[model samples]
Target: MRFYLQACLLTTLLGLYLCISEDSTNQDEKLPTIGVSVLIRNKAHSLPYFFTYLVNLSYPKDRMYIWIHSDFNEDNSIEIIEAWAEEYKSQYNGMYITTNNSSGPLHSGEQHYVKWIPEHFNHVIKLRQQALDFARKQWADYLFMVDADVFLTNPDTLELLLGKKLTVVAPMLLSDGLYSNFWCGMTENYYYLRTDEYKPIREREKTGCFAVPMVHTAVLINLKRTVTDKLTYTHTNLQSYDGPVDDIIIFALSAKWNGVELYVCNDYVYGYVQVPMEENDGIQSDVEQLVNVKLEAISKGTPLFWDPFFSKFVDYPPPSKYGLDEIYMINLARRTTRRELMEQSFKELAMDVKLVEGVDGRTLDFTNLGALGVTLMPNYEDPYHKRPMKTGEIGCFLSHYYIWQEVVEKGYQRVLVLEDDIHFTPYFRIKILLLLSELEDLDWELVYIGRKIMTDDEEMVSRYTSRPGYTYWTLGYILNQSGAQKLINAKPLEKMLPVDEFLPIMFNEHPNDTWKSYFPNRDLKALSAAPLLVHPTHYTGQEGYVSDTEDSIVLDGSAFVDGRIVIDHATSRIIGRINSEL
Candidate 1:
């Protein structure tokens, strides 16, 4: 009887162990249902790539559901998605595609334009919410929101993200150079806070994941754990140092309020797809498109010649024996503060500089101004109160003229003329020499180191080639004796416009014969180093310098055409275009 009782106990223990083992096996085999929610507003071109990666995810398609929300009928994105859904619905748990009428105009003008600000921000927020709402209703175990522009190059991206078991996480999506989809910190007032850790995070040699204040482009949420907690993509009243906040910031703030931490993973690579140049919406110029392509190539670990004008890389050439006779810096005498800044800039460039005392426009006699044929147009308008060239403007013009006189009188072959507010890039000297070598055969009147091409003239020569065009500003340039002699002989005093404005007239044939006869269009050759070798010191804000040019301006209501300067805070929030690794 004792042996029989022991045998029954052993049988019961074995049965219990088998039951536990079967249950564990079932749990290991069960796959979580994942819903991919994508909103396609204007990304029809990206559909082919997006669908290719989506269909190829390492995660089981039988357990995955894809929901595409599109509003654009023109791109045929809806048709493509519908066909994909029809073909794949049987393979997956569910496939859904929905189209909602877009809320705003079909094509809002250039995104960078000031007109489409908060309106653009609100439109995007609404679309994201629509996607989120649709995904939430499907009872997905996990919901992933991806921009059409993001191409998931990793096959196991979904599986890898699921392993983290985090409430919210995103893969690192980068553009061009150091720009990425995540900001490391936030300021007290909620602006993009730049911390010292930014470089370390961006330049990490090994793969790792790190916490970030905000995440965008591609993100995953554990819907069962996080989304059910009533999180939302809503607009808030948060204000940054610049203007009103957008949905991304609002989402970040909301998540933080709910005690949810956002993380970005850089353990694997993903491609931020770039728009093709031919399909570009005419917002970016051809030159910009070429630069974007070059930058995109560099970001993908490809080696190429680093054009300092357009790239952050600095490849210095050996110091050139070619040297200018003298470097003249035009600065106001009373501005001892500005003079010091110029001195520091010259020292950094290893250049010997002479300071040309600027003529104070305010102190100039206005009674004889008409003799110089200076006339303010009756209909002239200054948007930034930049017109009606102040006494400072006259003084600045005369300073360049004085330098021109010195160049001609001293028989200097070439002189470097720089503004007091000039700032140089690291490879400035090398770039200048390289540019000179390229144009050695051609005689150039002026070579602009830094200038703003205000007009959209497609006929302009390729950058670095001696081109005839309308360019603005004179921050840094090289003028030869012949150019100086032409300026002195032209007697520019006859029609004393701002020096910058007069330059184009001097270079081109003017309609007015009085000016045309004296300043006949000579080979006033000018070229710019693309990406520009110099910028205003104020832009860099080095040496505790403030702009002496615009510091004293007081714009009254009367100055504006509409009696008020319109502020569109949304313009600041627009994300730049993505450059693809391909």
Candidate 2:
């Protein structure tokens, strides 16, 4: 069995290791078939979320089978399952459901629930054993037992677990509080024991797959393991051992008795499980509680993106820029075409934008630059043959400088600056909103949404960052007042470089050490996103590609006709033809 463990190279590694994951991910091969077994009681409200995430798994559906056992549900859980199965049953390799009609599930706060604990455990154990037997009967390579309330946002979760090749393992799932799926230790009497290693692993201070005594909620059983056949969910299987009536506890005990070590991988965020709210918790409804849990997850830097199906219940991108204060677009006066394209794009998304008139380098001379307090620094070297700074470079620098001046003038706290030549990612508005939630409390200044990295070794400061690394681009970034003021006070005009060139220098990422000495503070706090959300709409050699700075080229020269920017029918026809090919 090829474990294929290489694909999960930790994201904390440099870009060199990233290449390994990239290469492994592109392989064309079928993954091992696995069975997903789930038990549903009175979890009607949570079923849709679980099914949505299940269907959205990156694993090949045809290679995955599902076994669902429903019983003791009072909230139309059986009806919901039938409806879903009717639509999606054929998609999986096989899907089976066993129904047990019995009394309704009792909430934790109910007076009789404590008295019925043993009965509840009996039903759970029977269902779990049935699931295990069903997987083995179908010759499944593995079985993933997940509770209805366990929310998994990561699509690659199944594959990540399979990569470990451990006997029995579970991905660490977070609850609203510090609670997780895995326990580091158990007491002599087979109860909870808070071990010294629990906190570090739970908080992810120490990462990687760690051997743990027990894991529950959502666990993966390696059916291929030789000793797995001896594992049992029924606690009575072991006569001498006396543990609680919990199915999971018994399963753990059974696995331990058979010399199967359980492990939990906390290498990254998968998703979370709902921590049931008490009656006096003031939660209005189950849906409201789910929303609260999701919001908390977002604020804590755990990415909780869901499939587009969930968007039907909630708005994807906010109607307004929820996290940003303002958005500014820098456009040259002569480059009216790019500005028009940008306006059209933003209009489609209903985004509010302010157009800042850019300084036209074509219309500038040496005296005009000096008048504007612009001068090249002593040690500035353009990698391209150490070429002299062009008037276009000066204009580009001054354009951003003026925007920084505006950021400082209005005291805008969170500002997004955009260049006219860039195109937004398909879900730019939605992704930016989600990304901003992660940065809400971070002491950030400039974060690039689009950039060209100069260094091979980039540090991901957060889930989406490459800080303290040299990158080249001024396409799109979020800026703050302090950073704006710092850039203004840096005397950039006194020693000018291209806006793209200066950002790396200010962030202390300039490859050349000489540029760093001149501006030793290097404290602008700039970083960039990985797999940048924005990209240039046009690049060199593309038909419509044009650069105002270099080559003095203009792709679209036609000005307004009948109060509308117009392109010649011939060019339009050619563009239409080109787009059709795409």
Candidate 3:
């Protein structure tokens, strides 16, 4: 009995020791090894950028294995791939290059050929299968199949996709228009079906991952699960529409039949750039230009979308260098869509912005107006004849009021306010900073970086000026603490007017006697940057973009033209004008 008890104790201690050792092993488990299979055919021009993208991925290069399959009889793709392999093969776990020595060029379908045919599409599947076989032999944990033309701009793509832990996942790669990686749905005949979720999936709020039937261009497949389940990319023998199917549809259908789920992550901007087809005119030049622009933007720490605009201003520094750390920046966005767009824009400009959830006047309680000591004026008339202030206007006014209250409470020296639809020029921040520095001693109450110079006469006072007439926009402006106090104390809520109109009243005297008068000591010393630094995105409709603000209102024939006419200081001539239809 004593020996048995001692044996039982020893067994229990061994069990506990093994459990602790297993737990520690799990904690320090190695990252999964990824095998990247790329198909290159006549893509020498895009190879440089493609390799750069691969090298910059935020994944362990030592654990990645690359396999390049080139089948083009013409072009320098083979040479480039060979050079890349020689240089980078040592960094990765393994690197392999295979070039088809076929006497004739591989049959790529015509420029406009639809990919529904089996023969034309099977070639790509064969090459992919060959690479997959290689990866399987190497015991890769994951297999990432990527087309040579897909340019990944986001460094965290691999890391993010790995976190999803899905059987198969792909990042949505977008090109010129609606073309992307995933199909929304399929028709009864197995053709691609366009569903309503198509566009919204591309533009929707950063909600979550989306489940889809098919994904291509850049797909990450969990080989560990797939191999265990006996999945193969070469399953083109599957029937779709009563005929042999393409590899993408075949794989998707196979996964579905096997109860495997596929997902596409749209939570963040993946910054994917798909190279245009060769049939497009000047394809080489366009691809080169895009590559240069993207590389430059990355180097400058700016978003890729800003490359085109930034290219226009070669002499000026990138927006990332201009810091607004001293100024409190507030952006008013009502809907999630607006907020997302505004935040993305700010990020591109490297601006640190705080979002103020805009007040929706439609849902506002009228009884609450009494708390602000304000009342809606009865039979109020708008001079522009555009329309009277709606709940939207009330909401806008309240938003400003709330911001002013916070400013007073926090005692911030100055705060920059921006509407959601505002767009900044290349040197907007620099110009605004310069204007502020120039007027530091002027005791200015308000500075308009971009505004409708509603004043009849132009007043120029050392890059700062106050006009006789009232200005009309609140799109982008800076309000000092004094201005905030004056605005809060004015209490225009007694007979509430549009925020723009009420602002002038606060600056001047209350046009009516019912409101509290907090007119400043010096007529609210104000200044406007000449040739405005910023303008509404929908100003001229040159870009054919709609304005959410104007669209919300019911307008008559009145065309509400606003914003300053930008000018070249040296030339003293109009450079750009901001015009809008009411």
Candidate 4:
């Protein structure tokens, strides 16, 4: 009897130990491995958003791994990333994959330097392969490759990806006003439309914007394919070339070679928000005119389309006029002499004033590319002083950077960003000022006339979802104080589209949670704001070349210097030096 009791107790203890051991293993494998790789160039400002996004994803902590690769040696981002990874390792298993010093070396003037200098293109391809290798080593199930700025909005994004066995899940293409290529056409009687004229506007050429549903960012694929197929193919294909495969054309071509079926889901998995502008009179005018026309032209005296979810249009009481004087107009060709046609229009539109004269390098620090020059007017002593010429477009990044960091510190209501070349009609100014007065409480960051020409089709442009006329164009967009500050506050990434492309709408494939910017030019009825016109037809006669010629630059690969615009050997443009003061 004693022996029997001892045996039973030993068996029970052994069973308990086995159960505990199994539980421990299960705990270790908490989340499924989801391999993700991103590129973090010199611009580290975009880092915090990406990190914050990773933190918010609804997935198991131990299951995911992220690799960030940068080119600049020991770039300033090293410390920031090291600190983040150290702090978040317990919760999120993040890794830094750098190629700055790890790769092979080449002889410099005096010392040996790393040879593997991955710029935008080669960097993308390298990172993709690196991700696959890491995944294979980690035995990760899948890989998600995207730009560092991309953020997941739907926490269930991981849940959606779980158990999916696809080669590519192409993210939906959302447009920022800059990249909108599709031209929309409005019917002749677009405003206060009658039933007979409500046909779909057609006869416009389709641009490439909406055609390719697949952008490289937010690409999810099986890990095995990424390693054996994708990586191997890239090496074989681009073996002779030492460039990157980051461009959209390369992405599409690569997917074709790999025979990957692309899937595009519109679940707002990622949100691309940007800083807002204060001068979005185009959108405001459209919304007002559209709503007012609809309400007034109602034969049955019906209220505006009042769907709570979609319909945000509401009528308010008339405004009390303050009798504010009209503001001065700006012209782009003011400094440089323009063609006869542009000059005539300029005079007719009260834009006869020329751009301010060029300033010295000491005053206008164009070399840094971050320092902007502004000349304040005496009468306009208010905050809206400091009118800069091409700086509004070329040096916008710097302008906004300064306004956010300094101007916001002192209580400023708004920041008006104007381009010297833009011409405004009297009606345009009146309607815009009125709209601004009306929507005073609107928490908007960006306001601009989306002037990407409307074609015959009502579906004017692709990439961007629109309401009506004067869609958001990058021509002359404005950002508010908060929007400015946010851009200043956030870390910027080196690899990015122009400022126009980086705006909220264009920033990501998905929409953002906190919509920081808006183009309120939805009202087709109100034609008062500046008419969004086509691109300038003429270039200044500075380049007096009757025929094309070729020019080239020689580089020692020692130090970098910026002189007259130098087109690299890669670009499609014929290499040449036109006469230019720069």
The predictions' CA RMSDs to the true structure, in order, are 21.9, 17.1, 17.3, 28.1
lDDT (Cα atoms) of all candidates against the true structure = 0.63, 0.74, 0.64, 0.40
Candidate 1 backbone collisions, by pair: 274-580, 361-391
Tens-place lDDT digits, model 1, residues 1-582 = 999999999999999999999889887666888888787754544455566667767899888887777763444556566766776788887877787556332535434322346656677687677677777787778888887766676779998898888888998865444667778989876668888877666655546888889887788888888544556676542333233447677777767767888988887775544433343343223223323423343323331231122122221224222477888888877877667655544443456778788876545554455555433322222335544334455567778988898888889988888887655653455577777676566667777777667665525355565454666678888788888888877776654545776676677722334434545654565555655677665453544555544443222222322121121235522111112310
lDDT of 3 at 227: 36
Give the per-residue lDDT digits (tens) of candidate 3, residues 1-582. 999999999999999999999999888678999999998876665676677678778899888989888874455667777877886788888888887757244464534322224555777778777777788888999899998766678888899999998889998765534667888898876668989887888654444789987787889989888433455566644444252446776677777767877888888656555544443444344444344334333322343442222232222224432332233333344455556656555554456667677776445554445455645544355666635445566677777788888878988777788877666654444466677677667767777776776656666766444442466767777887888887767655655667777766655623443322433332566666776776665554544454433444321122222212233457543222234421
Of candidates 4 and 2, the better by lDDT: 2
Please write out the lDDT profile of model 2 over residues 1-582, one tens digit for every residue. 234444445433557677888889988766789999998866666677788888878999999988898866556778777767877899999989877666555634444432445557777788899899989999999999998878888889999999888989999987645678888889998888988899988778889999888898899998987799999888767878777888878998998888999999999788788765554433224544455455444434343454454444334223355557888889998777777767655653457888999878676554344456655665454677455455577677888888898888988998989898886654455577767887775777888998876777776877766574777778899898989988887887876667887888887878777666767678888767665878877667875677777753222222212111122454432110112223
> Could you tell which candidate, 1 or 4, scores higher by lDDT?
1
Mark the regions of model 3 whose C-alpha exceeds 4 Å error after superposition. Answer: 2-27, 101-119, 226-228, 236-244, 275-582
Instruction: Rank candidates, TM-score, best first.
Output: 3, 2, 1, 4
| TM-scores, each model vs. reference | 0.47, 0.49, 0.51, 0.37
